[model samples]
Target: MLHGAGGSGEQVLPYFTALGDRLSMAVVAPTAQQPVQTTSNLDLAGIFGSRFRMPRWDLAGRDFPLAALRWALTELGADPNRCVLAGVSMGGLATWNLSMRFWHSFAAAVPLNGALSIWESFGTDARTRALLPNTLPLPLFVVHGGKDERISPEFDRESVRTLRDLGHQEVEYVEVPEGAHGLDTLGLAEGSPLFRQLERRLCRASRTDQSASISHRANEDTHGRAHWVGLDGITPQRTAEVHARWTAADRVDIEASGARRVALYLRGDRLSPGDMVTVTVNGVVSPVRFTPDLATVHHTFQNTVDPGLVAEQVIRLDVPQPPGDEPAEPTNRTRGRDAETI
Candidate 1:
């Protein structure tokens, strides 16, 4: 479990109580790294008043909360394959970002009254808009308020549309007619439909074996270029694929089998004049055309290798830096901002 901006683990403890005793599961509510003295009802009209903002979960780039979650699961001896991630407000935004990058890590996800992307909240760029269709086909239970003015409900609706368009079949979206940003006000009570859906997903995961799964790891270089690594499952029959949202100077490495048709999805809207992508499969290099939008690059090798043999394929994108003298600084929009109230 995670808390919203300006909220602590103690603040969200009541949400755990609402689950009741029907679900017997170990829960871990990790507190944020930074704390705020302001409560949920703090006034935000004055700019220089007694205002505070807690540290965000770092969903966009660093993903510090994900590392903490892994440590928590290890310490508690909990089965991460059967885990469920639920959050509210800014925590809800982290839910979407984390789950999308680590699709196979959780059985299901529940995000309440949250914006799907940074584009929905502050503004839009090519990178943010490109992340829309990459929502994985995980069983998602979304709850929002029709009267929420802080974060528009249209973000949830558009997210649902993008998920459905990307072939997500098991999606449940519920809208409270008169609810606000609070979980209780959103109708996630003891016998609510959201709980029922979560229970069903938990039951289904209990009967399946998900020991072999694919996971993604992301890192950024000192120059702000992103790097992604996708590890396929151990089983031979599973299809190997990599999905990534990249800037111009990003690099990706995928471990795949020769028998599998590797599908690579690359999203970049700021392709330079001489930008080119080099795909190296088992040391055979080939240059591919770089489009100004999303591109699906597919490669199938005729030399069939053993299904168990995994080979590392490299994709190096050579993009010249933009001709500007100003250095870019990373910014966190969710931090130091006033949070929506109940």
Candidate 2:
């Protein structure tokens, strides 16, 4: 499974807990081999990654990521023939590219509200056609938001139409109800009919695969928030880290934005010095900082969750435990940030 733009497997996992259970599949959310800078949330464009950006999926990514995926599959002892490839945003684009490049690898491919190019179509000459015909049909699970104006849901329709025009036999298209560009954790929990359809597709291949439980399920909270299927309940986890002395001065606001990668920002969390400082947020930790003048720093962390689950939203920042004085209560703040549902 891959995440959207600005997301590593880590950041996007929480938004897909239900998908995990529905598929009854073990998941691999390896971090991107290297960070890619992107600005657009759609088409998985990175705002500040040095490693990748949109329009670079053509044999243009680092080798390590694919190598790592191979290693991971081997470690899982998974049968590559039965593997399903699914991703959102840039990851979706990656999956599309992989399907074309490694045509024989995946059993099924799912690209959620993403753009894909086979590259083979670009060339008009005979050699190019011989090298890459319109290509083979891929069983697809195409999902998108009917109202996602950012990239426009119509693009998804066009993709499906293209596949049908190419004589593809199997194509499953799902349009989320009242959906938008960044359908994050809340949107998932708000409940979508898409879940049942997704589950059907996930398990469609293997009535025999029932013995394998790729993931677990979580009980719904009072408000209907769902966690991971196999990794149920909130795991009260804690760790320690230092913070910018400057963060003490800036009021940080966390925004879920209804998409993966919880975003944290402070008007001026930057310290007087231009140094990288360590800080923790929402019991999750990160290490990046800015100078006093560069007060605005957005730290986005990803997690996968069952989109339909509901729970209290809180963020805990680990402030340094000052030696002489009593340690401050773990700073607690609440925000509405969410992991993307795509």
Candidate 3:
């Protein structure tokens, strides 16, 4: 849990108190550094408005609270895999930024009344546009005020749209009717929607493995897929000719444990007749054939490994490659892109 600008970790104590013993997990709330100096020319009410912006916690590559949080997690013996990143306002922006850069580190994220990108307050450029899609597939539960004048609701809406367009399946957004920038009016008690969502996510984390997967549409169309975890050796380049679809040669790496089988689901329309995909698990490879008549192809590999041993599995397609073009490396943009309204 993180705090918004002009706020500190202390402000969130009430939320913890509200949760009581329902939340047994350790909480870490790091304060944002550097006081925001006020200017006399600015209207105090206007400054309090949602439109008024402050320098982000990590602006210009300074990561005060994030670094503090990471250290605190270690000291507290917290499970990184079960951790949740959440915040409001400027802290909401920090949540989005940190989650993107460390997508594999957390089970879920909740950003309230936060802009999808810093470009809402800061300006934009071509470089920033490339970074927009980096926040893909991580489960996000976004809450915003429909009547929020501080940071328009459109930013949150656009984020959901862009994520869905990029094939992310688990993004959820909720709007509080006539709600303002703060969630004070919305009860944060047990059985409330917000508490329920957090409970469900934490429960899922405790029961699931760390296995991660990426879709080709995320890579080719939206440029949203990041590098795979537990990857070994060399990474493949995306051939130029296969830019729009998943070819037989596209590959994804997954680090698995306590696994009995691996499943690969492919969109049939993307494959040409007689196209084949290869699934490699711990140095063993199996080839799968695809036909035009099929709408989806499900390939399963039978292999069992001990849960204690971390294994790296690679899946590559055997498709035609364009001449002279290097395989496309996965794109990773740690920063936010230009803001686009819904």
Best by TM-score: 1
TM-score of each: 0.58, 0.47, 0.56
In candidate 1, position 1 carries an lDDT of 71
lDDT tens digits by residue: candidate 2, 196-281: 66666667642121111111111111101111111111111211111112233332322111111222222222233444545443
Model 3, position 299: C-alpha lDDT score: 15
Q: What order do you get sorting by TM-score, best first?
A: 1, 3, 2
- Model 3 scores what on Cα lDDT? 0.50
- Model 2 quality (TM-score): 0.47
Clashes of 2: 54
Off by over 4 Å in 1: 18-20, 35-52, 61-64, 118-125, 206-342
Residue range with the least summed lDDT across 10 consecutive positions in model 1: 300-309
lDDT (Cα atoms) of all candidates against the true structure: 0.50, 0.42, 0.50
lDDT of 3 by residue, 313-338 (tens): 33343332235532344343221111
